[model samples]
Target: MKLSYPVHDIDNRLLLPAGTELSGDVLEDLISSNHTTPSQTLPLLEHGSVRKDIVKFISQPPYQLIFPEKQDISKLLKQMEKVQFVLPFLRSLDYFKQYDFTTYNHLLNVFALSTLLAGDLIPDYEERIRESAAGPAHDFGKITVPLKILKKRTPLTRAERDILDHHTLAGYVLLSYYKKDPYSLTARVARDHHERNDGSGYPRGINLNDRMVEIVAVSDVYDALVSLRPYRPISYDKRSALEEIVGLAEQNKVSWDVVKALIAHSRTDKPHYQEVEIPSEKRGAPPPGNVYGIIAEETDADASGTSE
Candidate 1:
């Protein structure tokens, strides 16, 4: 396989230039190389030109709505400015930006929302920084998924759905095994964000107790619900989207505290958990069904149980 852009080592050194053929042996050599230190991308992310662009993006219309309070946005920006950027995180973001820009934008939205939510949910500063960076990279495995499946204007077949669901495991392996990320938390979030408290999520059906993983999970689903898709024209409104997540919380699929943090950001009135109630009759398609219809046999085990 060949990449559209250049590939960099963990030290920000060039490993392969644009259009370089990536043979199996070459990939093995790159992955096996001993480069475990943090990448130089940290300074670039914190004090570079990208920081300015991020400031502009989060301050705009839709993202601005996520942080209604200016002080909240200011606090998040301060925290982001001190974050430590890693090689796999940068490489993953670059791949998404070049191949699938829609997913890239969605990741940015997730990063913004997750960081904001972290301030309220995660009390520790170091953990907050980790959560902020992990947000955009949570779907890093999606880069392995074909662009056609990602941009399909119709329902996914059983085979196609299987490929899509494998991204979580793929991402974990890429970051943990191949890239050898020093911070294991990022790799864990990549694997566990799709997991649920009730053991219903895909790739791995284990119960998730990690708050950072849960934060990313909530942000991931909320963005999927509210964002407009090419296949599905109209997305759920803010209130309806929150209600859908709340319904999941009621089912014990996700954490109430994480969901409530999202509600506080999105809802201006009655954002408290006690006031937020599941609708008598749930609206919209249920989970991945609502995001994109799936066409597969009910008995297909691999495709049977995938959540957002």
Candidate 2:
């Protein structure tokens, strides 16, 4: 099969650009390399056009989400293009055939949703960009997980679950290694996105105080609920997904304010998703102090806990 997009090595070096036809030798080589050195996760280009289209959709007026417009889109794409390491890390899942949705698309959905929610809470432009970038990078550690575990339809065994839970820390390590920023928003999101506010979530069960992590965590769960999974045949509708998030908020598992923002943004009054102004009374207070500073103090060892 021909390459749908560019492929990159673990070092962020381009292996092949989009449109490169895959040959028997190339496929064999990739398979061999993958098996021989499981730690080196390669990146691949997701459908660039699809990414641009998603951005365009969210960028239109009635601007429901915190997506970039034409010029902003150009800048964001350029920024992402420079972060070539992200693709290879994500493309590791390309080898798994049973995923309900491509990792790239899933990440894209999370990024869009996270940014939308972030825009509602965070007025800083630079921070919004960081949250947008973190959405895709949040699952980067899944690269370290074995494909067999990732594609399994049955419930994971206790040991299997433990291994799988390590993906958060793995993702954090990968991003930190590549980006060289231990406290980078991308790295922190990868590690903390799976956490819950009530300290019931996995990886580390600590209460998440950072708004960005909270936004990405909520967006990740929302997308996962609405998207089909190999283990779950049916994908929940958007309304159901929102309901689930609201339920979590009610239970104190997620941020209520973020959920309110998500509900406002996803209002069904219009034909398309548009931003709706949530009442100040209903909205949660913005996180206290410099959130990034709070995040910087955290370490990977903190989120090292796993779930069953």
Residue pair clashes in candidate 2: 42-88, 43-87, 43-88, 64-275, 141-171
* TM-score, candidate number 2: 0.62
Candidate 2: tens digits of C-alpha lDDT, residues 95-152: 3213424555677667666765665677684534544677767887666565665655
TM-score between model 1 and native: 0.74
The alpha-carbon lDDT assigned to residue 242 of candidate 2 equals 67
Q: Tens digit of lDDT per residue, candidate 1, span 1-308?
A: 34444444433466555565545565566566745654455532553345665666667654567766778767777777665655556666666667776686677778777877777777684644755667776887776676777876667777677667766755654565444553467767887899999999865688986888899999888888777765566776776787888888989999999888777666566365446544468565533434375574444643543321
Candidate 1 residues lying further than 4 Å off, grouped into runs, are 1-62, 126-128, 177-179, 269-291, 296-308
The deviation in Å at residue 256 for candidate 2 is 1.0
